[model samples]
Target: MVDAVARLLRRGLPVTLAAVDPVLLELRGVLARAVDPGDEASRIAALDGTLRGLLARFPDARYAAAARALFGLPPATPGMNLTARRALAAERAGHEVHHFRKRVEPRLIATLTAELLADADRFTHAPLIAPRLAPVSARQPVLADPFAWEVAEQEEQLSLLWSAIYAARAELLAVERLISLRAERTDIVRAAVTAAWRWAGARAEAISYTTAFAPDLTIDELVALAGWTPPLTPGQTSRLTEAAAGGVAREQFVAHLHGETVLDDTWTTGLLAALQSTEPTSPEQPGAGGSSTAVPADPDQNG
Candidate 1:
């Protein structure tokens, strides 16, 4: 039976290899740990130390050279970062789940059913002649025991069949879930991309405003470039649109539209006073013309 299973797997080697390899490696590690935890730890530590030494010795080695330097070592590819490793592990797990559901589990069920059927056949066709009967009075008797055995075998086979069916159903459900998770993961990546683009654009806009520089394109152009369309009504546009027919300046617009001040006037006044005290102000300054005189700089600089 094991040989038959081996042949079956060999025929489907390409399909099964990826699904089985990780599982086998993990199982081997577990068994090794169980057999000698200290030995396993030492082995791992030695391998890690060897790889580190090789990396230090050949910091610039590429491909084949790198592989040769770290020969007999486990994977050390930096590209397989923790997150990538986790994703790969999840993919492997899903594949293994699929393989077990499709191949291994079905074989086990079939084997059990076949064995039960053979047992039932043997029980139902057993010889029932009595050895103690005299030659002339010999009687061929029915085998009640065989019938009982056949009934037991039938029940066992039914149970096995149900178990196999249940297992297949479970595997199907799990595969469906795995597919759904993959789709969800894709959606998450897309959402993250969109958010990143929006953040970058907003940051760029803020920097442009702070620098008092006109952007290469207008806000409307930016919106168009970003593939967005305004959904605001006329009233909403009046409230937010700086150049709308009934729009006010940004500060006043925010205050009136939101029914609250855009900023704390007290805080603004205090900050402006602080800034004024730190620097000399000209009497001809527009907003500062009626304000208090600023401090004068050192006379040494007037030379």
Candidate 2:
């Protein structure tokens, strides 16, 4: 039976865990009924052999690595700052995966297996099967009935074996849940990285536009046009100076200046009105001219 289980697991743990779980449960049930005080040594040895055989097939290292992979991992090459942040998030997720696969799971399986195997030895070889009628004190010579001691010990073994079986079953359920959780975490990190890249793309566009348009604007206006809500820090202000020193292309700068002027309605309107007012009025023809009339100024009126 152990060989069969090991073979099933070795074929493919991802596919066979479900299949093997039911078989293990059925074996637990059979072991529960077959437990006898007189036959405990043989029963325990048989259970141990089966469990050992199964463990041999599904080696700890093999299953542990598979479990780690199932819990998803971060990308190896994090190129950009945004990518690095995404990688950090994935690494944290990997830690959780490792905890379950490397530490928690193996211990649980080993513990339950040990408990079942130990039960057989304790039940069969116990010095007393039942409890004594009277309590033995340090001053009194010890006396215990072997038959009663064996009975009590066997009962305790049964309880422990049942508990081990239940605990192992619960651990298997936890493994299933962990598998689902790993997939969920991977999706969350992937979405976060996608969002970061999108925002970075937009920022790149802003940087390109500002770099192209900076020369047409005053240092103060260029800073304003950077569209930063908070005032630039000292370091950022210095970086802006360095960028401005590189300068823009002559044609691009002049074209941007021209566009700025064309777009200013107030300045355009005022300049056009001044130009029109300064133009000379057409001279009146002599034949069309009339006699001029003049009025004397009164003392009360100022010239």
**Model 2 lDDT on a 0 to 1 scale:** 0.34
Top lDDT model: 2
Error of 1 at 180 (Å): 21
Error of 2 at 42 (Å): 18
Write down the lDDT of every candidate, Cα atoms only.
Answer: 0.32, 0.34
Q: Which residue runs of candidate 1 sit more than 4 Å off their true CA positions?
A: 1-77, 81-221, 226-230, 243-251, 259-303
Evaluate model 2: give its TM-score: 0.17
lDDT of 2 by residue, 63-82 (tens): 43332222121222222332
Alpha-carbon shift of residue 98 in model 1 (angstroms): 8.3
- Local error of candidate 1 at 218, Å? 9.3
